[model samples]
Target: MPRPHGFSYEIRNDTSVHITHQGRAAATLRAGRAAAFLAEVENGDAQLVMARWTGSYKFGNERTARNHPRNRR
Candidate 1:
């Protein structure tokens, strides 16, 4: 069997690509990095939220990608 609905890429302006799966935020890729994200997704090297700490992908509407896995203050 295969995934019913896999990743979906939405180009937000000229330098961004927002990736979504089943309506979740998933990942937001910037510039040419979109291709790299796609390649990862394609090659099964990463999942929707795989780049959990990558500055390259801005996840969620609140831009929580950077602060994720928050460090103790």
Candidate 2:
């Protein structure tokens, strides 16, 4: 199946997490706390920090008028 347009995942430092459509850091957990992390994300209580790294797609999601809203065109 195709991936959801507004949902994505990130793998960082051995942790994998699902983020929301707004690019807000939804949840994070240690390798051993995968379930806990997901629980937080799902429970709407996680305060995950926005990820900062080179090549993150978050930049592309910003409201930039330089290109098409969806494709950065």
lDDT of 2 at 72: 61
For residues 1-73, what per-residue lDDT tens digits would candidate 2 score against the true structure?
2222334446566565545445655445456566555565566523332232112334444455456657663
Off by over 4 Å in 2: 1-5, 14-20, 35-73
The CA lDDT of each predicted structure is 0.55, 0.45
Per-residue alpha-carbon lDDT of model 1 for 1-73, expressed as tens digits? Answer: 1222444566676767776665777667786677666566666744433443232343244435446667324
**TM-score, structure 2 vs. true:** 0.28
Off by over 4 Å in 1: 1-4, 35-73
Instruction: Give the 10-residue window scoring lowest on summed lDDT in candidate 2.
Output: 47-56
TM-score of each: 0.40, 0.28
Clashes of 2: 2
lDDT of candidate model 1 versus the reference: 0.55
